[model samples]
Target: MNFALGRYFPADFPLHRLDPRAKLLGSLLIMVGVLGARDLPALGLLALGLVATAALGRLPLSLVLGGLRPFFWLFLLTFLLNAYFTPGSPGPLGTSLEGTSQGAVLTTRLALMVLTASLLTLTTSPIDLTDGIERLLKPLRKVKVPAHEVAMMMVIALRFLPLLAEEAERIKKAQMARGVDFEGGILKRLKNMVPILVPLFMSAFRKADLLSLAMEARCYRGGEGRTSFSELRFGLGDGLALATSGLLALVGTIW
Candidate 1:
């Protein structure tokens, strides 16, 4: 399946209509709540909130869950490390009960964080996201932060995700056609991936080089005098979204 993490699914929904600034800040607040969650109940509440948001946005359940696919191994590794290393009462298979609990909680937190970010990208276009970020960071100019540059870099990175995923998929298929076996023991699979990874890196670099050339050709300067075509305005929807996110953050942190 195609990677869906950073790809926006256009839809006329409440979330898609909100200002990107609100969505960005709301996602941050939800992340804070995810981090502050100390127990399963808090985690469950946050999870429910995410599901509700997804539902409100009319996002497909499959697409939302698919965003988690890329991190499956990371989640597994995190759980295993915590379960095996954390000191606690003894439990099944030489794992501690506390360790297992901690592992579960930590994994859940990680998943929640990823889902929050996925929702943000799914709802907001890259252009709006960049504008929102730059505007939000404008205050930091007092401290000499390159807000526009930073926002541009961030959005560029996000925009590259789907491109890279597609490139990797193409390379994998080509290798498979050449009888390259990706299915094997862990070590063998790792060794087999070299062919795909090497080509993928080269393709990525080439794409980056082309992008730079295209920018230079257009006489592109920094965001110093940049003007946006669509000015973002905070409306009632933005306020309500921020308020709800703030409430959730408070509950997660305090409860």
Candidate 2:
């Protein structure tokens, strides 16, 4: 139940001290680079850059691998489906060789994308991320867009992702204690999940209600005149991170 989905892990590393704005923009660029990569060599370079970034951030390897555990089935499914269905020369086991290659590339691309995003969240706090999003979207406010509200919604959704996973685990345990068999066919598993899903939804709603009440009690309002306690400033580390991300993107494009 030690899921790290979009959860912040604090460390005094350079990445942790970087301005959220820099990380947000830099991460976006790196993600775009990952998605735009069309060759294995470029993808390999991108993967290397990601690993180096994680090392630079002082993030634990266990945390990175554990965060990816939830997506193992997804990775497998993506590769399987593409390998079996894509148009290519037939290979061993009645699979297309080219299709399998493409599938492997795609799966790697997806894993790199997820890892990059997870790193962003692991280094940046939820509050800083929220503020960064709000500031980034401020220009849209002139068009009557609720930038602050949107950022708040995004942050809340991210903050709850891991909590929801933990809650689902707890519910599963409770159901198992009551003799609910989660094994067997897909349909049987689906049936077993009903009890867990219902209560998890209810719990989420209850938490949302309490949160609303807490906000009301504190007289909380939108970010119209809100001031931040820690001002985000672009520093040397922030510049380096952005430069590195941009360099990766450039190399990915040309390589």
Q: Highest TM-score among the candidates is held by which one? A: 1
Query: Model 1: runs farther than 4 Å from truth?
Result: none
- Candidate 2 wrong stretches, greater than 4 Å: none
Index of the highest-lDDT prediction: 1
Q: Would you give me the overall lDDT of model 2?
A: 0.88
Across 120-225, the per-residue lDDT of candidate 2 in tens digits comes to: 8899999999989998999999999999999999988988888888899999998889999999997898888899999999999998999999988988898777
Worst 10 residues of 2 by lDDT: 1-10
Q: Report how far residue 151 has shifted in candidate 1, in Å.
A: 0.4
Q: Rate the local accuracy (lDDT) of all candidates.
A: 0.92, 0.88
Per-residue lDDT of candidate 1, residues 14-105 (tens digit)? 88999999999999999999999898889899998999999999999999998898889999999999999999999999999999999999
